[model samples]
Target: MLATALSASIAGVDGVPVRVEVDVAFGLPGLTIVGLAGSAVLEARERVRAAVRNSEFAVPDRRITVNLAPADLPKEGTGHDLAIGIAILVASGQLDGERLPGTALIGELALDGGLRPVPGILALVAAARAAGARSIIVPAGNAPEAAATNGVAVHAADSLRAVVRHLAGVEPLVEVGPPGPLRGEHQARLDAPDLASVVGQRVARRVLEIAVAGRHNLAMSGPPGVGKTLLARAVAGLLPRLEDDEADEVRRIHSVAGLGARPIGSMQRPFRAPHHTISTQALVGGGPRVRPGEASLAHRGALLLDETLQFRTDALDALRGPLDSGCVTIARVDGVRAIPARFMLVAAYNPCPCGWAGVDGHVCGCEDGARRRYQARLSGPMRDRLDLHVPLAPVVSGLRGRRESSAEVARRIGVAWELQRRRQGGANSALGADALDARLGFEPRLLALLERRGRQLGLSLRRLHRAARVARTIADLEGSSEVSRDHLDEALLHRPKDAAA
Candidate 1:
């Protein structure tokens, strides 16, 4: 006899429908799985056999052949265990195959017959719905994740026996209802230490707001304890909450990375602060399993590299393409996959090895060559990508004054962000050269000033475009219709000083 069941597997944060085909025929007692099964899928043979027997179902001692359809697609993971087992039971005449069509079975099976929740259940359910599945069977632990997706009937089964009973019409599993919007404790914000926590550095605070409001990359250099790190953390809350579409995109990436629960509930943007010792593959997403790295994990959010000078030069350089293109395409011998990496880069670093290259009172202990090499670690290309480069000074002693809070800055940022999205349909940093021209519409005097400055600074076309966008963002914050001289002047102040030097 033969039977076919619908199943699904994950592929680059999405799901692919898999047709689990099983055939039981006369021959020596053996089992084999074909259709380009990865090691995880092949190993499912023993797991399914044991789970069937342990669940009090008969395991036919005949030649059993299982094939995952779409032979060209590489099938990995243990999600197919339950589907293959159920297909065998139906093919062996123990269970009816009538209910198998238009229903996706997704889960791992333990030796004792319990169904194990698998990662990417949400993506699997979404794929099932896209494939016109009428219902889906998932592990009970994953019910909440599955329920979060719309337009799918999800049945949570605890064990293989329970699934069998449901399929045999003996009893029906309870259906999970649609999950409501994330609220309260479920929506944990990233540790955005309040902007007001930093006692001073008013210029740095304003620069941080502009960067966050426009989704621009920013870099800060200062001696130790000058509030660079604290200010970096404060930028988190300055960002508005993710929109519904953006939240869904971020949730999909986290789900594939096996980052559970928090992303689904929070709707807050991702904030990834990878250690400086991270490898190139780990930073940009590559390993045996091709999981999402820090960059992709920070999709639709911020990626903070505290102590930017401490990171490996190669790893820092690896971010250039994604910084410009808003996505990373990691090509390995196995296959090439592109992952979304549209994130604001917030980086902080010390001025020198001794932490006082140019501080007035503190004398630098490191030699000039050491200082040069330390600064050289961040290449010109990497430096150029950061739109705002603010050099901080240590706070003056005995001057106590209150600064604006994150809530206050966030309100202004929210308004500015809404203006940008409404006017240009994206953040200022995302505007291309033509888009910048169309949006800025500066007068001849402002245009002449930019052109003359571009020549004096020897700014690359890319940097010129960035300056125009930044100026436009400044105008938006001031509620101006066109880019003004004051806006251009303020934007110029934030550029890397070396651009003029």
Candidate 2:
């Protein structure tokens, strides 16, 4: 007898549909699985066999051959365990596989006949639904996440015995209902550090607000004691909660990353701050498994690299492409996959090796050559990609400025963001050259002033365009439709300085 069952696996952040085909013939007793199965998938045979026997199911002494079809697709993980077991039972005349045509079976099986939760269950359920699967049987532990996906009925099963009984018409499994609809826009639900906790450095606070409001990439240069890290953390909370579509996409990525067990609320946005010692592969996402790096994990949110100069030059440079294109394409031996990395970058660093090169009233101790070498870690192209560059001064003691709370600042930022989206359908930082010229063209005098300054700064076309975008954002923040000379001047002041400077 021959039988087939539906199963799914994760590829990159999405899911791949696989058909578990089982054949039980009148030959010597043996089991074989094929179809480019990975080590994890190959190991599922023992699990399924033990689970079936432990569940009190009779094992026939027949030749068994399992094929995962469309044989071209590679299969991995123990997610196929339950499906393979079901297919075997059906082929051995124990159950009717044809009865569950459009149903997907996805779970790991334990020796005790128990069903175990697997990673990427959400993505698998989504793929099952897309492949016309009306129902999905998953481990009870994964039912909550699986139930969040729409357009599919979820059956949460606990053990192999329970599943067999359910399929045998002895006891029906309870269906899990869909979760509540994701939170809508216009709701501020981020749990982040309060901006009012940061005292002094008024300039840094204002720049942080502009960065968050426009989704601009910002670089902060200052001594260790300044509020650069604090400002970067606060930006995460100032940004609005993830929209419905964005939250779903983010959840899919997290599911593939094995972070589904974490308490990630639907509306929360990601804030990834990798240590400086992280390897290039880890930063950009590539290893044996080819998981998402910090950049991809920070999709639709922020990636803050504190002590930016301390990071490996190659690791820091790896972010250039994703920063510009808003996505990371990783080419593996298997194939190429693109991961979404539309994130605001916030990089902070000291001025020199000694960390006092640009500090007021402080003499630098590092040699000129060492300072140059230390600052050179931030390559020119990388600097050009980061738009806003603000130099911070040490905080003045007992002179705390009248700081606005994060709520107050976020309100103003939300207004500016809404204006930008209404006017241009995106944040100001995302504006292209054509859009910049068409929507926020500068006045003649302002353009002339910017041109002269560009010559003095030896700014490349990319830099000039980035400055223009920042100026547009500044203008937007001020409720202005056109870029003014004041806005252009402020944008230039925020431009990144040379290493020696």
Tens-digit lDDT track for model 2 on 1-501? 999899998788789898899999999998899998999999987888899999989676899999998787778789999999988999999887655688899999999899999988888998888888998999999998888887888999999888878887889899998776644444443556788788787788878887888899999988878888888888777887665677887888878877782323455678889999999988888776667888988988889999999999999999999998988888878888788888999999998888898677999999989998999999988988988888888877637557688878878888888898788777888888766563465766776777788999899888888888888888888888889888888888888776767
lDDT per residue, candidate 1, 245-354, as tens digits?
A: 78887877887887864444457888889999999888988776667889999988999999998999999999998998988887766578788899999999998888
Model 2 lDDT-worst window of ten: 182-191
Q: Tell me, by lDDT, which candidate is best.
A: 1
Model 1, poorest ten-residue lDDT window?
181-190
Best by TM-score: 1
> Can you tell me which runs of candidate 1 are displaced by over 4 Å?
182-190, 261-266, 438-441, 499-501
